[model samples]
Target chain A: MTTQPVTLRRRRLHEIVSPLTIPLVTLLLFVLILLLAPASLPKLVTGIILPGLTLAALYFLIAAGLSLIFGLMDVLNFAHGSLFMVGAYIAWSCNVGLDPLYPNHWPVTIANSNARFVIGLLVGTLLGAGLGAVVEVLLIRPLYKRPIYQVLLTLGLVFVFDALVRSVPAWGSDSKAPIKPSLLAGSLEILGRRFPTYSLFLIVLGLTLAVAVALLLRRSRIGMTIRAGVQDSTMVEALGINVRRVFTGVFALGAGLAALGGAAAASFIGVYPEMGLEYQLFAFIVVVIGGLGSYSGAAIGALLIGLARTFSDHLVLELGLPTAIASASTVLVMAVVLLLKPGGVFGAKE
Target chain B: MPINGRRTFQIAQSGIGYVPEHRAIFRDLTVLENLTLAERKRGDLRRSGDLIFGLFPRLHERLQQQGGTLSGGEQQMLAIARALVPDNRLLLIDEPSEGLAPVIIEQMMAAIQQLSAYTTVLLVEQNFRMASAISQRYYIVDDGRTVHTGAMAALRDNKPLVQTYLGAA
Candidate 1:
């Protein structure tokens, strides 16, 4: 009888502790940071917050699509990063007529104007979306029944796409920064902190897209189909929805989003041939930390990792630690989250 | 007719409700959304609500709950409820009593029997008792081929055939 009471108490304790793991760890991390570097508070608000949100926004842009595509199709698209790289290269070409493959070839004075820049962004996003659609139809469609083949095909595409970009005479292996539009080139003062205007634009764009996607999933018929498809796709087909077509649409949507994220990232950090791998690595981490197939998990995971990385960077600087700690912080957080909640905060329990 | 080839949705659009085996309800969606998604014709949606609620009153209480969170019995109700929401001319129910407590199975069998009054029910079941209780005609297939065909009452009289094909029930 006494043992039963103890068992009940232990179960109660677990019920309470399990839900608080992430928040409690987050609080403890903040307390430790404050104690270790008390002098960095102003910098935290002034420097870290906007940039942290901007980074989070960029992470969300890539991770959201990754989460959806994985959730619905069960395909791990390794080419996502390469798609982002291709998008940046294409957008760059549109801005300045460097690549013969794009609209403004060299000696075409139609390049470098603000109108051209706007046109570049539009063309870049649309073409990225279009390329994603084509890839789905031509390559992904045939391999739906063979999951291993899908993985191999996407992994192969990563190398092929990277090599294809490098082969373009205009793109090459060098890094090129796209000039920011005049509207986004300036900086804004927030709470006496001057922040780049472009970063704020990214923050707004990411937030807007997140809401839009969430609303689409929650409210639309297509969204219903996706949610159902994720659970049991064959049943969805039996229900009379064109599930094959939905698969293609979702793959294209995910690729397009990743490409747009690449175009946006081009302005923040100059576009290099290898940039896609860097962002893709982080995008994978964000997806894992968020829960593999959960959209809200992706958004929350992005915010957590974004802030954690930014704060760690500041800590490294303030404490004179090696710069590698900043890079390692996100992985550490992921490890902790996985240890506590193996399925992720929002992922379905295994 | 050849049923218009492989596109299942087109066949569904022609007003056929399918309750596949294993209660294939979307685990992620709410009970209401499950019903809402099956609504092919908006004009007849009001009738759907009345029919489903009338058949399985327990679902009305769990409208907001996710399908996966429900008990197996409840999930089966949601599956049957989902197929019935649209204005379907025929309902093809597959093994509603596959995995259920005797009590739940009785309730499900009763619900299916009640629904047969509203639409054509083509039930495929291995349970001889359930198959005989709810159906008029009977077709017993062995190894992907029909071994016998007769009325349910006639099949009940054939003790040897029941023992050979269906086993003692």
Candidate 2:
């Protein structure tokens, strides 16, 4: 009887604390900034917060795909980084392809950067999905039961993809500037502070994608099969749905999202061969921090990383600390999160 | 044709449903999702759903509830309903009355009998009363080999055989 009361109290405590953690962190930060560095509050909101959210959106875009595939198939796709990198490059290529025809062949981008960006995003997503399908069939299918082999094989595939990208001489340098679509070129004044239009777009896209994917998984027939298959795939096959085909589709969707993220990131940071691997590492950290195989967890993890990175950078500049320590903040946050909850913030119990 | 259990699992591409003892319903998905996913084709969903609903009307009320959230009895019904959704010539239901209330067991037994009328049911139940109720033939196995094989009535009469293989049927 005593133990039961203690357990109930703990459950009630958890119920109150867990959901509050997300927004409360940011609110507390805002309050702290307002008190100590009153002048920096607006800057933090515009410069740090908005951009951080945009970056987190990009990370979520990539990690969502990663989380879904790993959650369902128990396959850790190390080549996902390569997919992200290629997606950025593909988006860049699409921009170049559309540049010459500006106002001549395809008059859509003549005065409207919206059409151009949309087309570029579509091309990148489609290419990424196609590549994902090819990889799943050729590389992943044979290695499903042998999970250890999957890690080694996919890690090797990452190297192969990196080499292939680097071999393409026309691909140019990693530092090449991304397209500056006319419509997405300017900034918006929010409360008398300027905010990047592209960042706003990224945030919208990320949220929309989250809602859309959630609905698709929860409501649609195929999406239901995929969710169920993630729990028990062989049983799904017995139910008359081809689990392999579902795997292929999910793999493609994840790759497409990663590619889309890359393309979105390309608008700001541009594309590079190694960028894929770097983002791949971030995706892993975020997914881990959030939870394995959990979409919402991945998103939460992304937001935390994004906010932590911004906060660390601001702290470094403000306090005149070494700049190198900025990168470590993400790791520090992750270490702390893992320490508190090994399964991640929203992960299932082991 | 010689039937090896391993080969049967491997070769049978279609027309066979195996509900393993684990109650292999998609725990993460909803009851409707589990049932709808089992359809061979998108056509005739209404007809099949109505039929399943007729058997287990409780499932119709809990359509949106997740499979894993359901009680053991509900899950069993979902498993059976899911198997019946697709056009299957034979259903291999393993241990239907393992851990359930006697009232629920009675309901499941009745459902199994009704299911057998439409599709051939190959039930693998341990409870002697459950096995004998509907089964025409019974196979008693011990030490991984068949010890007795005959009609259910004959097996009932053979008390020594029942005692040896099934520990008193």
Candidate 3:
């Protein structure tokens, strides 16, 4: 009895301190790297850091949904990447059109590339959200009681989505680069370095979405249901909440975000049949590094990974190391983070 | 007889508030959020705040603290307060005294006793003293079957029945 108050106070203290550990260590390491690296500070900031932030923004686009879906439902949605690919394809079709020979019937034509690009993003997000809702109702809702079947169903969806995209008459497994609007096509100088204006657009978009999502999670009634449902869904149900409906809502929200990410990526990297799978892999890594079901974790994880990959690639180019090392760096960081904190940086303690 | 609804949430929506044995509050949420989410309809919580706060003033004090941070006794109070937030027709309280300190149990019993003046309580408890203290009637179940039922006063005087079933009342 005498020790209880002390224990509770100590626990509160630990809770306050634990979340800061990873970010502080990362910042310290970043400072150390800055001091030791041969490249000038301005060069590193322009050439490496800005690009890293851009990539991080893109990763967050996909990973946020992955983290939310996994956190709430405990389902490892392999098709998340496939959904990302579909979004890209949709955005591509909107911007570039399926066939050049056919009269461009799309209301906003290539003549209005900027409007078309914005329209493509909106359409992709809406359709992606719609598709996600449909999938949850038709496929996932029934398999809630059986864990393995849910896994199989989602895994199978990857192929289905991939095949469906490839089957599109003009798309036909070909990589297509959508035309960039003239307004955003040019480069902008950032801190004495020229950077793609579109990359900055992506960074801004990512940060905006992150803030919006955080606000939703923190403030709204639906957000309350989500946070509570994530912790103990059965109890939420017992408290008179329709957790199943929330599940569907979350799944749709995640899908919409991933689709938005894909649409945005299409403008940056162009779109291909396998674009989703490539981005999905990094998104998964980001989710794992940030902690499963943790949004802030995913955001930070994206930043860490984006910067890690960028810096490692630069180092590889400068030192003439194997290209494989650049790719391996993110995974190496994951392994080390897992070793130190197995649940991910923001993961709930087991 | 069948209840009004099919699902747990549906039944909950049908005006039944359940306080589970383990005090299954949303540990991650603040005490205020836990109460706010319990509202069945818009402004239900605002309408019911006076009664809840009156019953458990400690909860009002710890509005911003996480449910998990609360002590067992405080969690029990929050659980009961959560149930009271919605205009529940009947409250199903399970083992309010289970694992609580004696002082906390006495306070819980007093709160239940006062609330009973306004609401119907279906309390399932093994603590005979706490049960008898707050209740006007009693039922004895032996192996999932009710073997005896009577007024609390009658049961207290019936020493043989208590000895036979409850083993030294």
lDDT by residue (A106-217, candidate 2, tens digit) is 3333335666677778888999999999999998998887999999999999889888887877575456577767788899998679998888988988888988987787
Candidate 2 C-alpha error for residue A62, in Å: 0.8
CAPRI quality of model 1 = acceptable
Model 3 score (lDDT): 0.83
Q: Rank the candidates by DockQ, best first.
A: 3, 1, 2
lDDT of 1 by residue, B1-169 (tens): 1254747777877778899898888866888878887877664557778888988999999998877679999999998988888878888888888888999999999999898888888889988887798887888888999888978999888899999998975
Q: Which numbered prediction scores highest in DockQ against the true structure?
A: 3
Give per-model CA RMSD. Answer: 6.0, 5.2, 4.1
Q: Who wins the lDDT comparison?
A: 3
DockQ of each: 0.48, 0.38, 0.56
B39-70 in candidate 3: lDDT tens per residue? Answer: 98889889988888888999999999988889
Supply candidate 1's per-residue lDDT for A338. 91
lDDT score of residue A14 within candidate 2: 65
Query: Candidate 2 at residue B98, lDDT?
Result: 78
How many residue pairs clash (N, CA or C atoms closer than 3 angstroms) in each of the candidate models, in the order given? 1, 0, 0
Query: What DockQ does predicted model 3 obtain?
Result: 0.56
